[model samples]
Structures are given as structure tokens and as C-alpha cells.
Target: MNIDVPRILIAATQSGAGKTTIVSGLLAALRARGLKVCGYKVGPDYIDPGYHRLAGGEPVYNLDTWLTDEQTLLNLFARTSQGADVAVVEGVMGLYDGGAGGVSSSAQIARLLGLPVALVLDAKSMGESAAAVALGFRDYDRRTDLRGVILNRLGSDSHRELVSSALERIGIPVLGALHRDEMLAVRERQMGLLPAEENGDRETVSRMRAAVERGLDLEVLLEAARSAPRLSVPSLPAPARRAARLRVGVARDPAFSFYYPESLSALEERGAELVFFSPLRDSAVPEVDRLVFGGGFPEVFAGELAANLGMKASIRAAAASGVLILAECGGFMYLTKTLRTLEGSVFEMVGLIEAHSAMNARLQTVGYVEAEALKDTVLCPAGTVLQGHEFRFSTVEPEAPERFPWAFQITRKRTGATSLGGCAAPGLLASYLHLNLLGNPACADWFLGIASDASDV
Candidate 1:
């Protein structure tokens, strides 16, 4: 199917340039104009998209070039952004920064999807020099469609004027010049911007809308979003095929909210009936053939998670019974023997895996990894070359022994660092890497097939 998607990507010279705020504000501002807006984040980040959805009143999608291939990436954008008046994609880190060689940079996404770009530059400490910086980004890679610029954190009218005129002379349009306003800043925590679910209250959204309305030029954004080339791709992915139905329990709550819509939809497409339950509050694991635990702020609720002895025992019993269980970062921690909080207090976990976890003040690791299964397991052999992402402020304690059976052999894309992760058994696969099943939907097929075969009762 052929479609025309008027899309624009919001990128920054680097992180902390207020791009997330700008993107969120812009989403709110555009939606406030009575336009149907679809929001997307350019990488594997799961936090910014939450703010985007809260700001725009829609389900935000992730467009990760690392997790999903180019075709799958375009297919996702095309399928998700359908029937929207416009779409805004928030970029990660810097424009040209991604996995080594700028593999999945915001600039790369813009080029891949043939979309225009509007850069957000931090102007707190610079004036005319800001133009030089903008010029470098625009010129660094001419292939990227550098359409306009947003000057964030400008100190004054004079500062905005100084930067705008210099940029105008170089043929770059200044779409907006936003003053440094405290009201625009969102709450943040140890990892990054706090997820909107935790931080985007009504007052916060109102404040963000006001800030963007006051400083952003909505007409310029719309114009740039529509100025992109016609969207063309080989073809849309065929619809998912259904098979034997199986009940799959999914743990979802404030503590376990890291699931992607596509990943879950992939399971449904494979004929698995997804049943939502909560490890945070549910006293017992729901009756299902399989269970999945996505990542979230499980460590923040360590005390409550430990307090719920019944829930922990339920999960442990289920895992021990050989029920297929798949978990990511925070979920992986919850499966361990204990979780040591930042305060050094220890809390008992499910103990399904023979390891303990510790919440660290600093981020232990963050990057894209290619995971190769170390042993035969559901979805391991068929989908061994899985693309995954990891970002957490926690680590496993008394790390898995060198000879301990590993679920996946993970190789960091940037540093080539290799490590063994998780426990892989006949009916279990748990690890820190967050896998997008749509990237390799075969995994979902394999996973659901195992769920069906394992139900011999």
C-alpha cells in the first residue's frame, strides 16, 4: 500500500538540550490545535514516548533502527501513523550519534524514512556561535534533510535575535526560539527523564502546553512536516498468521510497564491470548500456559515486592513447575533471589533464578546488543540472532559463574564487549536485553508454539 506520511524528526546537538521537553511541548501544542498527532521516539528509549503520549493524547511508538530492521522500522511507522494529521518523532542523544558509525542515529532515521529534520539546539550559553554549531550539524551529512531549527533555552529576545539572524543568513530557518523557562523542565530520576506515567499529571501537561504555545511556531512545524518527500516502500508486511490458542499471562503495572505494543501484538498474532496480571499486587499468578514479565521500575517498589510473599512464592512455584517464563531487565531482577536497594537494604525476590540483584546508583550498562542463544530453548534456535537493547541502573550480584549455563551470549555493538546473561533452560529464558519480537517475529511463533505444546494436561 502507498501512503503519504507528513512527518518531522526532532533531534538535538546532544543530550540535555531540552529536546524531550521541546518534543513533548510540540506534541501538546499541535494536538491542542485540534490535530490528530501520532508520536514516535527514534530509538529504543521507552521513557520519552510515555511523555509524548501524555502530551499528545495518543499511543506513542518506538522507531528503533537497532532493534528492528529498516523495512520493519518503516512498516511500523507506516502502520502506526495511519490516519493521523501529523506525526512527530523524538530523537535520541545527538543527531549523528547512534551505535558505532551512526547506525541508528536520528539523522539515519530521517534519511531512512525520507523525513525532514528540525534540530533543537541548547542556547543557554551561546549567541552567534550557535549558528556555527547549527551549520556544522546541517553540513556534517548533507544527505539528511535539515529543514529547520529550534533554539531552546534562549536567555532573551536579544539572544534569540542574535542566533536567528546568523542562522537566517546561512539559509537555515529558525522555526522557534524558546526562552529558558523552569516550567518547561520535567521531573527526572537516576536513569533519565521520569516516565510520564509517574510524572505527567494534569498540571504538568498544562504547563508543557503553555510553554510550547508561548515559544513554539506551530505553523513552521506543520510546514516542515509536510515538506518531506513522498513516502514509498517495497510493501507492507503481511498480516500475522494465527495458530493454536494458548493463554499467556503478562505482568503489567507501574512496576512492570516496559512492554511494546508490537511485541504483545506479535504474541496475539501467534494465537496466544494475553492475560494481564500484576506481580506488584496480584496474590497469585493467573492460570495460563505461559508468562511474560516486561521491564519497569521494579526496584523502586522493592519493599512492597518483598512484602508480598504470596506473589513471590506463586511466581517461584510456577517457574519451578516448568511454565515458560520470559523476562527483561526489571523483570529479570524480580526473578532473582534478592534485590539490594540503593539504601543497602535487601529484599527477597522470587528466587526462580539462582542469582541476586543489586540496585546501583550509577547505570551499570546501556546499549544495543546482538544476543545469540547459548542453548536450545523456545525461540532460541530459530531466532538466535536477536537484536536487543539494555538500559538499567541495576546489576546482578554474585554474577553467574563462567561455566554456568547462559541463556544468551550478548555482544555489545559499540565496544564489542561480550558477556553471558540470564538462565536458559527448557522452559525459561530471562535476561537484561529487551527484545522486540517484531524485529524477529519468528521468536514469537516459536514462543507460542512452545506454549501450546507444553500444555499436555
Candidate 2:
């Protein structure tokens, strides 16, 4: 099927070039014009999409060619983009930064979807040299549709003109020029921008929209988006038609908010109804057949989580009764016997797994990984292989390391290094690796199947 989804990818010359702020502002500005806009992030990032949701007033989706194949990615893009006047995608890092061959880079997505790119160039120090940078990016990959440039952090009107003229001489259209304003900045911490849920303030989004309205050329940007050719999206397989026979409790709060929209939708499509409950604030776990905990900032709220002894006991009782559980990253940290912060503070966790998690001074792992199931588990059968990504700043130490039932033999895609990770038991699997179920739909089916059997028992 061929679909014409007017889309534009807001890419940057490099990281720290303010593309997130620009994209968030653009989404708000477009929505203010009474246009139904959809927002997306280019890779496996969960933080930036929170800001996108704040600005766009819609749930943001991810588009990653690494986590899933091109066909799946295109289908997801096409499906999520339905009923929208335009789609705005925020790129990851620099345009060309990704895996070994730029597999999941913003440039790759632009070329794959034939989307026009409006490069955000930081114009803090140089004037005409900005053109050289834009020229380099434009010619670096001829396949990339570098349609225009947006000058960010301009010092003054004169500065904007100085840079805009230079870009014009090289035949690059100047789409927007935003003056440097500290009020438009979002706070950051170890991971990246603080999740918008934590910083729940509509005022910040208002400032971003006002700034974009005053600085950007919305008409030109829309024109560039409309210039994209109609995409040939492959037909997706029909979802299983079944009534909800299983209840899956999903942990969701300020501390546990890193879930993929499609991953949750996949479970619902396979006869499971998701019931989201807060692990930090709720005194009792929701009555459900299974539980799911995705990655988030559990360590930051370790003290609060530990203080909620009732919630902890509730989860423990659920696990003891053979309630199947799946956790990743922060969710993995929460299921351990204890969590130790970087400041040497220790707090109690669920103790479902006989392991202690400790925050490290630096990141322990950050890359894509391939996992081969070591044994039969709720998610998959033995020998089942899946792709996932891991980004964490903590390490897990098992009480009896030699006796731990490691779930998968993980191979780091970038380094080819092998490691034994994840804890697997009769009805629980917890790991630091994050999986997108869209790429592993069979796993979702297997999970729901196991949950159904457990509910029957």
C-alpha cells in the first residue's frame, strides 16, 4: 500500500545541537495551528519521546531499523502516522551516528522513508562557517534529502542574518533561526533530559511553543514535509482475533515509565488486557495474571520504593504465587534483593532475585545485543534468539553467582563480547536488556499463552 504521510526529520549537525528542544517546539507550534501532528524519535530512546508527548499532546512512537527490520519500521511508521496532518521525527545524536555502518542513524531513516531533512545547525560561535558545516552534511550522503537548515542559538538579529545569508549563497534554504534562550532549556541528569513526567510543567511546553512561533517558519517547514514522496508501506500481518483472557499488570509511574507503545499494544492484540499500577505509590499490586516492568529511573527513587514496604510485599506475594513477571533495566534493578546508590546508600528491593544492584560511577553497558535463550522461559522457548538494546549505569551481583539461572547468552553486537546475564526461574525473567516486542511478536504470544495457563491454574 502506498501512503502519503507528510513527514519531516529534524536532524542535527551533531549532538548537543538542540534538536530535541527544536523538535518539541515545532511539534507544539504545528499543533497550535490546528494541525493533527504526530511525534516520533528515530532510535531506541525513551526520554526524548516524553518531551515529544508533552509538546504534541499525543503518545510518541519510536522508529528504529536496528531493533526491527525496515519493513516493520515502515509499517509502524505508516500505522502510527494515520489520522495526522503531519509527522515530526526527532533524530538521534548526529545524523550519521549509529551502529558500525550507520544502520539506525537519522540519515538512514531519512533515506529509507524518503523524508526531507531540516538540519539544525548550532550557530553559537561561527557565522559563514555554518554554511561549510551544512555543505559537508548535504554532500556527505547525496541520498539524504537535506532540504533546509535551521539556525539555533543565534546571538542577535545581525547574527541570524550573517548565518542565513551564508546558507543562502550555497542554495540552502533557511527555515528557522532561534535566538538563544535559557528559559527554553530542559534540565538534564545522568541519563539525558529528565523524563517529562518528573518535570510535569505545562509552562515549559508553553515557552517552547511561543519560542518556535516567534522564531520558526512553519509554512516552509510544512512545505518541506509535504514534499516527501508517497511511501510504499508493506502490509502488516493481521493480529490474532481473541478476547482478553489474561490480565498483565504494567508498572507505570514517574520512576517506571520506559515502555514502548507498540510493545504494550502487541500484548493487547494477543488476548491480554494491560492494567497499569504504580509500584511507588500503590500499597497493593493489581490483581493480574502476570506483571511487566520496563526500563526507567528506579535508582533515583530507590528510597521511596524501599519506603513502600506494602507495595514490596505485595509484589513479592504475587511472584511467590507463580505470577509470571518480565522486567528490564530499572525494572531489573527493582526486583533484586537490594539497590545500592552511587553515594553508597543501600535500600531494600523486591528480593525476587537473589542479586544486589549497585549504581556505578560510569555506564556499565550501552549498545545493541543479541540474546540466545539458554532455556525454556515464559517469553520464549529454548534456542530462541532475539535482538535487544542495553543502556545502564549499574551492575548486578548475585548472591550465589555460580548457581544463578542465567536466561540468555548475550552477545554484544559492537564488541562481540559474550556475557551471562538475566535471572530466569519458573515464572520470572529479569534482565538489563530492553526488547521491543514488535520485532519479537512470537515472544508476546508465548508470554500471553503462559499468562493464560497461569490464570487457569
**Top candidate by TM-score:** 2
Give a tens-digit lDDT track for model 2, residues 1-457.
6658899999998989999999998999899889999999988999999989989989899888878889988888888888899999999899998876887999999888888999999999988999999999999998999988899999999999999899899999999989999998889878878888887678888888888899889999999999999978879987663464888999999889999898898888787889999999999899998999988988899999999999999999998888889999999999999999998999999999999999998978888889998988778887988898998889999999899989999999898999998988778888988989887877887787733343222
Best by lDDT: 2
Judged by whole-model lDDT over C-alpha atoms, candidate 2 comes out at: 0.89
Candidates' C-alpha lDDT: 0.83, 0.89
What is residue 159's positional error in candidate 1, in angstroms? 1.6
Q: What stretches of model 2 exceed 4 Å from their correct place?
A: 241-244, 450-457
Poorest 10 consecutive residues of model 1 by lDDT? 448-457
TM-scores vs. true structure, each candidate = 0.95, 0.97
lDDT of 1 by residue, 1-457 (tens): 4447788999999999988888888888888889999998888888888888888888888888788888888878878888999999999899999987887899899888887899999989997899999999999999988887899999899889999999999999988878888877878888887777787476777777787788888888888888877776667555455555788999998889898888888788767899999888899999887889899988888889888899888887887786788888998899888999898999988887788899888888998888888766655562367889988899886455765557787899999999877777557778898988888777786677743343221
